[model samples]
Target: MPVPPLPNAFLIRPIAHRALHDGNRTRAENGRLAVEAAIARGYGIEIDVQPSADGDAMVFHDYDLGRVTTATGAIRQRSADALANVSYRTGEVGIPTLAQICDQIAGRVPLLIEIKDQDGMMGSDIGTLGSSVAKVLRDYEGPLAVMSFNPHAVAEMRDLLPDVPRGLTTSDFPKKDWLLLSDARRAELASLDKVEAVGASFISHKITALDHPPVLALKERGIPVLCWTVKSAAQEIKARKVAQNITFEGYLPA
Candidate 1:
C-alpha cells in the first residue's frame, strides 16, 4: 500500500509542552498537566509510550525514572498502579496510562504515539512496550498513528494494529553516543536505510538532519516527513521549509 499521508495538521502538540506554566515550570512528558494543556489548546498530542512491569502501556519518555519522577531505576520496573501513585518533583502530577490520556483527550485532537523500545531497541513479549501500547490503542477511535525508532516495533505495530498509520523515527546515523559501533550497525539502528523494509508510512526525522540524503530521498519519493522538537520560530521556519509537519514545544507556532 502507498504510504499514508502525514497528519493533515501542520503543528503537532508535543507532550513536553503540556503544562499550565509556560517555561521552566512545565512538567515532564506524559503528565496530566501536559496532556490537558495540549487538549485545551486544541493541538494534536505527541506522546511516548513504554510498558510497565504489569503490561500496561504507560505514557512516559525516559527509560529511567530519576529524571522526571520521585522514583529511581528503570520505569519498566514499576507496575502501572505503582507508577500512577508516583509524583513528579513538583508534587502535583503523576504518570498516566495511555488509556487515561486518551480518555482525557477524548478525541479532541489528533494523537501521535511514539512506542518506546525496550533494552537492545527490540522488545521480547506481550509484556514488550510496543505490544502493550498496541493493545491499549487497539480500540481507540480517533486521529492517531504510531511511530518509533525501533523498526521492529513499527513492523510489529503494523501487524498488531494494522488500521493505525505507522512511521519510522530517524536521526543521523551513528548518533554521537554510538560512534563506537560499526557503521553498518549504526545505520541499521538509525532506520534510514530500511524504511521500506520496515513498512513505514511516513518519516519523523530529526529537524536538524532534514537535509540528510536519506530524508531528502524519502521526500522526493512523495513520502511525508514530520520533523520533531522544533522549539523556536526560526527552527519552525527552517523545519517548515523542509518538512510537511512539525512536532513542536516550548512556544506556539506563529
Candidate 2:
C-alpha cells in the first residue's frame, strides 16, 4: 500500500501505539520503550496523559493503574515521583511522566496524547484535565497532537492551548446500523465535513466494524484515518483491510 503524504507531516505514515512493546521491552503499556519502538521503527507514537490529584502531569492511560502497573489506587491519588515506583512485572518500567516522555523523545516522533476526562467514569478524580494538559505540553519540542472522546475536552484544549494539533477517537467500532446516533447528531459528527471543524487533523476509529460507510467517506476526503486496538495478526489484517494504516500493540508489521 502506498503511504499517503500527510500535509505538514512530521514523521512517517504508521504510528506506534503505547510505544513498541515486544519482548526485550518493558512490561508496561505506555512507557519509554514503546515510544522508542515507534522512533526506532521510524513511525509516530501515541499515548495518553492526565493529571495526578496534586496537579502534576503524567503519562498514563487508565483512570487507575490497575492493569498496567503494580499500583492499585487511582493514579490521581499518586504523585509523579510516587508513580515512578510502580514498575512493570516482567520488566522494570517505572511509570513515566509527560515531561519525561516529551524531554526524552524530543523531535523523535509525533506524540499523540489523549487527555482523559472524568465525565462518566466512576471514581475518576482527574481534576481539570485540559489545564493539566496545557501546563505539561507547554514546553514539549517535537511533533505532537491531542485527542479525546470528549469533544468538550477537545474544545477546552483549543481554548486553553490553541496551537496544539488535536484529533477525535471513536469506536465506530460497532456496526453502523447498531449505532444509535440521532439524525442531527449523526449528521454533525458522523460525516466528514463536520469533522473538519472539530479541530481534528486526523481521527482514530476502532477496527471491529472496519470499512464502515462513514469512515470510508472520511478517507475519501484526504483526511487520514488511524485504526486502533490492533493487537494481533488477525486484527491487524482486519484494520488494514479498511484503513490506510494503524496504531497497535505488540508490533508494527509494516
Candidate 3:
C-alpha cells in the first residue's frame, strides 16, 4: 500500500525543545518545553508513549526513568499517580500523561505520537499503549498519528484507532543506551523488511539512513519519508534533499 501524506509540511520533534528553550541541559522529550515549542513555533510535535504500571499511556521517551527523572528504575514499575509525583531533572515538571499533553496542545498543532513498546515488556496486552492512547484521543479533534519502532504496536493502533494515521519509526541502529538490542535485532527493526506486513502508512527514518535502499524504495513508491533529529541547518539541508519531511530538533531549520 502507498504511504499516506503527512498532516504538516514538517514536524518539530520534542528533542529540539531544549535547544529552542535557551539550551536547557535537562531532557527534552516531553513536558512543557515540547508543548511550548509546538505552540510557539507553529510546528507539529512528535511525542513518545509508554504505559505506566497501571496501564495509563504516559507521554515519555525512555523505558527507564533514571535519565529524565530524579527517580530510578523502569517506568513501568510505577503507576501513573506515582510517576506524577516524580519530577524531571529540571525539578519543575513531572511526568505527564498523554491526556495532559493533549489538553495542553488542545488541537493547536498536529501530533506525531511514537509508541515506545519494546518486546512486550510494558504489558502482555499487545494493544495496551495504543488502546490507552486511543481512549484519550477519542474525542480529540486534531491532526494526529501513531507511530512505533515496533511494527506490532503500530498494527495494533491501526486496528484500534482506524481513523488515525500510522507510521513506522526506523533508524540505522545506532548503538545507544536506549537501543539495547543486538545488531541482528536492530537490523531487523531498521530494515523495513516487514513493512508490508506491518501496514505502516509512512516512515520516520533516522536522518543518516534516508539513503538506505529500503527507504529509497519506499520513497519511490510514494511513501512519505520523514527523517528525524536533524540538529543543524546543514544537516537539515542534506536531509530535505531526500526526505519528504523532517522531524527535527536542536536548532530551527531554515
Give candidate 3 misplaced runs (Cα > 4 Å). 1-5, 8-28, 120-127, 174-187
Please give, for residues 17-123, the per-residue lDDT of candidate 3 as tens digits.
Answer: 22233333554457777567657877777778888999999888888998767889999889999988988776656788999988888887777888886565322
Q: Which sections of candidate 2 miss by over 4 Å?
A: 1-11, 23-25, 121-127, 173-194, 232-238
Q: Give the clashing pairs for model 1.
A: 18-34
**Per-residue accuracy of model 1 over 8-66 as CA lDDT, tens digit each:** 65235433333322442555566777778767777777888877889888888888988
Q: What lDDT tens digits, residue by residue, belong to model 2 across residues 1-254?
A: 12223335433456667677664335455787766767777777778886776777788788877776666889988887787888765466577888788887897767778787666421124358678778878877767788776566766666676777776776542236425545554455444443555566667787774566777877777677777878777777777766667777775566
lDDT of 2 at 83: 79
Off by over 4 Å in 1: 1-5, 10-26, 121-127, 179-181, 189-191
Clashing pairs in 2: 19-34, 19-35, 20-34
Residue range with the least summed lDDT across 10 consecutive positions in model 3 = 13-22
Global local distance difference test of model 2: 0.68
lDDT of 2 at 140: 77
Candidate 3 structure lDDT: 0.74
